[model samples]
Target: MKEQSSRKGFAKFTTLDIVLMAMLAAANAVMTVYLSQVNQALNGLGGPIATSTITGLYMIYGLLAYYIIRKPGTALITYGIGAVVQSFMGSAYGILSCFAAAACYLIIAEAVFAAFRYKNWSLPVMMFTGGAMVPVWFFFAAQMFGYTKWGTGVLLVALCVRIMSGILLCGLLTKLLGDALSRSGLLRRFAVSRAVES
Candidate 1:
């Protein structure tokens, strides 16, 4: 009876969940490569501020997967897979940095959802989760890229921009995309589809 119950519980993550996670991770890997070039161009043009504006886009895929899956460990697992995929796909930041970035995102995302017991999928919750994920990676990036020398005021401004970008581009965009997918019936078997219907 215990073994049967364990199997039933483990069945929460179905084949579709694995496929969706893999697809999103691959997509994230591709986007990461493309965005690295964009980041370089923006950095040259308007410095950190310009590059920070698109920070949220870098984080969306994992959040979108979490939003759709509405499951514990969704962000972490997707991000881990994404890091592996990014490393193999020729990330500009190289292999270690790709995994580092994924680690930073998953840590915060997992904490936030776990705090809510992974039950709340409201817009505010999503925005908070997205915005909250920014600072840790930003700190690491600042240290790595010598952004600390840019003066405190500039660093603060860039951080703020990144947070706002996280809220809008990652959080809001995930919600919108999840709802659209749910409405189109593509996510009918996912928890998000039922949430949307209710």
Candidate 2:
């Protein structure tokens, strides 16, 4: 009986779910290579602040996958697959950094959704989730990229920019894209489409 219940629970993820996650992960991996060059140029132009502006874009795919799937482990699985895809795509951040980035996103995204019991898909909640994913990874990145040496004021400004970017680029963009996809009837079999219809 217990094994049957477990299987039933796992069955929540249809094959479509797996396929969508893989597609999003692969897209993210390819985008990461291009974005890294953009980030490098931005960093050169305006320092951490400029680079921070696009940080949320790096996180969008996993958040988008979760928004569309609305499942407990959606972000985690998507991000994990993204890390693997990024490795093969030759990310400038190195394989370890790619995995680390995914891990960072997984931690915050899972915790935020789990905290809400994975039920609240409201705009505010999504924005909060996106903004929340920034800080912990920012902590890790500060040390790695020497952002700590940039003085407290500069660090705080950069952090704020990143959080806002997360809210707009990652969270808001995910919601909008999900809704658009839902409307197109392409996501008809997904949880998000059901949510939209009801």
Best by lDDT: 1
Candidate 2 lDDT, 1-198, residue by residue in tens: 999987886789889999999999999888888999999999899988999999889999999999999888888899999999999888776788788878999999999999999898989988888899999889988887678999999999999999999999998888999999999999998989999999
- What is the number of residue pairs that collide in model 1? 0
Give the CA lDDT, 0 to 100, for residue 134 in model 2: 92
What TM-score does candidate 1 get on C-alpha atoms? 0.93
lDDT value for candidate 1?
A: 0.91
Candidate 1 lDDT over residue span 72-93, tens digit each: 7788789999998888888776
Question: CA lDDT of each candidate?
Answer: 0.91, 0.91
Q: How much is 42 displaced in model 1, in angstroms?
A: 1.1
Clashes of 2: 0
